[model samples]
Target: MALDSLVSNFFWSNSDGSGKIHWAAWKNYRNLKTREVGTGHYIDVFKDPWVPAAKQFRIPVNNDISVNQDMVVADLVQERSWNLQPINRKIDKLYLDLISKIPLTSSPRADKLMWAPARDGTYSVKAGYRAKTSAIEGRTGVTRASPSKKVDTRIWRRCASNPVCPVCGDETESLEHLFLLCNWVKVAWFGYSMGIYISPRNIKNLGFWLEEFQLLNDSDFDYSKAYVASMLWAIWKLRCRMTFEQVEPSPSEAMEMTNRAMKEYWEVNSLFPKAPTFAEPEASYKWRKLQSHTLKLNCDDAFCKKNGKGGIGIVCRDSEGLFIKGWAEQVSAYSAFHTEMLAICKAVQLVEEWGMQSVIIEMDCQDLYKAVTQCSFRHCPWSLHGLLIEITDPVQNRSLVSFSLIPREGNSTADRLAALA
Candidate 1:
């Protein structure tokens, strides 16, 4: 309201290049603001983005017909309902269903401008910049998704210096050629993008490419769209680096980058997300005895970052530190800490198998220790529920059972056994 009081809907008007610093941002605001139709007065039906989910939030215009900028949404209404006559006469039937579905009123309540991207109709500079960064339906051969559109300077780059494809150096680098038809881009889509096997058609239109590309993700895991977007972004960056900077574009680089990002994303969102870093106690490393009757089970796990395989090792000993039983096995695991939890689970199985009482399980994972011992996992992520429940259920059932953290040096024997697995 204060901004409106200052400039009187500056968001809707073009501030001419009068050396204003906010000109680029000022231009982006009009495109993203939608209209919430109450009275529909002052809401330009042809220009405003009022139709929900319509392409660019506006109805598809017939290029043959000249558009009147003065045409407001009120012009299409008759008796609290959308009159199809004026709409069909003007914008055509492309978004007639979407238009009719919109909630309107016959009363004189003023139309409200809304920031379309946000759930709540408010705007911040961060949201404004985000909207601007994603506005690429390929008006230019550039995208903000690239590494720092700032590019060692604040000078605004509209397009690359060369129109030719920097990677192939054969054809003009349009958005279609760069993303869909580029030889390098094709390799990335097939190799890095979950082996998307859509055969290349000689399609020049990106819209047609998107329509066909939707079929690439048919798996139970719904990560295809984000994965595909990441691939496209990587390819865009590769081309940008090659064109703007002196860096050579590598097809493998783009594919690998996309693959790495998607892999990390999958890890985070998957059942076994990456664990937070935990600090160990700052004391000299030594195994401690609780009681003479208590059987100390030292558990540790080894995870190969190179491969996804994990090794669980558990060693049971008397209070005197003499090993009574040792067990090791290889299995699939999600993270290093994940394997730690698995090791504890296996130790619990050993406890039940051996049918022992007065047991203490020790592990090298401090975070897991704190999470299991101090925190109730009921409110934690479901990713940890299955494993935490497995380890903690026995603890609840058995009064003598407990868990504690040990230093890496104190857990060296179990570590060795795990490595052998």
Candidate 2:
């Protein structure tokens, strides 16, 4: 690379803080160099010396010198001098991609990459998901019949003498046995990880596995992919520690380390502002079509905590806030949110029965509101069982219905009816 090009790509400040150089200024200064150095000099003297070294080394071997000096030079290049700027840039781009586009709810891939859903680019949650999945997969496989077909006298010999399997100890271990089968991996997974497990099939590769798990699972999945991935990373770190430092941590100690790592990851990744929750194109289109309407229906419900009695209320008002007529019904229900949703269902049914069009539905529950308007809440028991049931017949035609949220104070009529119920 030309000195001018290098100068153009980076900003520099003087030691005394008295001067600064933009890439353009630095590049111009470099171009003023009276003598030009060869590419070899640039790589050996400037690039290798300045750039941080990468884990993988790319040292050029030269046979120009006697053995001793040449070996020393090769060793230094391999051990410390290789430039890592390219790999660092790649990692940064990966983190950026995670924050800008990937959804948080994905399961981790085997390669240790997961789509981090937060506004910030952090991998704590991803690690948690991966570790949990790996542990579970490990446990599952261990509990099942061994894949190895050979029956051994070792297996039948006094099982008590070998309390711990030569392959796996009493830790309920399997996949960890295959990839990370050891006391260290078990301590991290079983001890720190709250006993959650993910199927091994989801893990793709070491670099991006956790990330794949995060990608594969949705946000509402039982296991939090981010949390699992964090655990996996911590386990890997512990492995490195054991290998290099000759230190072995007990299960409790490893759990503490896992917590600390997860905490730090969350702090770095979550402090930044989150991106706006994006709506799918089809959802956005449907939302726009419904919002184009004029009349809005606001519904609510209130239940007595002591008993299951509740009241359902629905009010139809124009955009200007004038009442178009409203209805309040008292009912009995164990679930208050269910009752609230029932009101919307009934209101929608009533509107359709009356042949009314262009209605906007308002509710206090966000989940219920989204469920009703999007027709995507079918999975929610109450939203599906109660809310959907009420509007099923009514929504069959050309009417537009939307859902929104209003302050509790804005729902005086519903409040009064609920009090009565």
Over the stretch 1-421, how does candidate 2's per-residue lDDT look in tens digits? 6997668445565442223442232232221111111112223321232111111112222355223322221222222233333233323443222112111111111111111221121234343444344545676774323333223223433333433433334543233342334555544565555653434454333335444555666664434555566666666566456546867645566567768876887787789897898776432211222333378776888787565567888877766666778787876553676577668767777776766777766776776666666665343442123235345445656446555676666666666665665
Cα deviation in Å at residue 368, candidate 2? 0.7
* Candidate 2, backbone clash total: 58
Candidate 2: residue 221 lDDT (0-100):
46
Query: What global local distance difference test value does model 2 have?
Result: 0.48
Show model 1 residue runs off by greater than 4 Å.
1-283, 378-381
Model 1 TM-score (2 dp): 0.37
- Taking the tens digit of each residue's C-alpha lDDT, what string does model 1 give over 141-169? 66433343234222322365667777788
lDDT of 2 at 331: 67
